[model samples]
Target: MELPVVHYSKSEYIETDTGNKVSRKSVICGSQNIVLGGKTILQTGSVIRGDLKRSGASNFVVVSAGRYCFLSQSCIIRPPCKAHKGAFNYFPVKIGDYVFIGESSIVQAAQIGSCVSIGKNCVIGKFTIIKDCVRIEDNTVIPPNSIIPPFSVYRGSPGKMVDELPESIREIYEARCKDRYTKFVPSVDA
Candidate 1:
């Protein structure tokens, strides 16, 4: 898919050596524990809570994102937390390549597979696992501990599997994420 060129102010972004374009307005806590693979985009107002880690664990990664992932504006990517041994501990959040998380979405998922497109204002609850080639519709609310299978379209309050996706969705979704990344450019007037 070909996306229209979207211009952003050059001063508002920080392009890393590994080709990750992160908005300065985004709040990324505990960056040392957050691993963003090459060519990922962290848009304005997005929050990655890498600060939340397992209790008493050292040098643990809280959030890991793969290449060409796009986190839209105001989205929150936080690890799921649960009580363990009478103490609260946060788990890791793993996001695969070419995943696109839409605006205002709150993801507390344990894992999100590749080629997934999550729509705007959705709430992916804690410990949820989303498999590859999945599409989540806007305003959907997935319950905690849910496991979404591959090649499915999920929506609604409990985020049920509403439809099935084609096998070619992996290629199509990857192309869409690549196009979106390439089209998100900086304006000429810095």
Candidate 2:
């Protein structure tokens, strides 16, 4: 199908139960079932797609922004599926409030919690639970079904818990979320 062209620039608030946001310079194909909350920024060169409707289930991608969330440049979020047919017949990706997904990352069948920071070029695997206040560094890969505890720093390939972040850093993270809420503006077109 030839999808309609959609573009957003200059920071507008958009809220929709199901739609795709294609940047003027980017493409988002087959993400018709995705839900983007108000003030969520879908930056340049990002592509988010899912086959939820094709597979006969509720495979929509949900991005809930309590205040604000940013899906940075060149990121891909798709449903988790295996090479074989019907492998990923059932799995969806869910991201929560105040999440910052950095550039060039692929997240599949993952549940990311509030206040999470996923660094650039990271690959979050299927069925993983990334809890709140977690900082995943750049170029890391999180294996499938791993439960990352809250308030931790995970790094390296196949990502391990490096350590508990300092309390001060936690405070800073909390403060950042607060700042986002304070500065958030619901999209005018919402």
Candidate 3:
């Protein structure tokens, strides 16, 4: 039997009942290696490259995102690469819950912990480890193999930790993520 082909509006994204709003235009490769936890929102033009598999390991996962993660417009999430014992290998990019990746940001980090806020046009270098509750300002360039400690505010080129994040903003960021998910509905043109 043939299934009916359903066409959606230009402004409409693929919204599941679990509140995961993924844009139809987004390119998500290597589905087997990519994991999207419930209530995740991948906005328009986002590119998630999970097809770049690990060396000599066909069954390894390339990318994973936890609940309420928002990948904004034109953002590119790629697996980190490294040289282990003179052999190049691609590592997984693991993202925790309540993460917001801003527009046109290129992330090649190995680990991005919970409640991380990355601003627009940021370039996160390969193998960078971002701990929980980190706030990265806009247009920052994080160096490779660097570690951002928890609750730190990072900014500028080569990304420096400017200040510490207040405990109060944690709740605010969480609520903002939830609210954005709820309001991230398709735009219906008149």
* Top-TM-score candidate index: 1
Question: What would the TM-score be for candidate 1 when compared with the true structure?
Answer: 0.98
Candidate 3: give its CA RMSD in angstroms: 6.9
lDDT of 3 at 160: 96
Candidate 3: list runs displaced more than 4 Å: 1-11, 188-190
Which is better, 1 or 3, measured by TM-score? 1
lDDT score of residue 127 within candidate 3: 92
TM-score of each: 0.98, 0.72, 0.89
- Model 1 is weakest, by summed lDDT over 10 consecutive residues, at 1-10
Model 2 over residues 1-190: C-alpha lDDT tens digits?
A: 2223334443442344432233555455555566665445566777676444335445454322333566778987776654446353545567776777889998874688877888999999877888877899999899988899998989999899997876566556556644544443433454
Which pairs clash in model 2?
Answer: 13-187
The models' CA-based lDDT, in order, is 0.96, 0.67, 0.88
lDDT of 1 by residue, 1-190 (tens): 3589999999999999999999999999999999999999999999999999988888999999999999999999999999977999999999999999999999999999999999999999999999999999999999999999999999999888899999999999988998998999999982
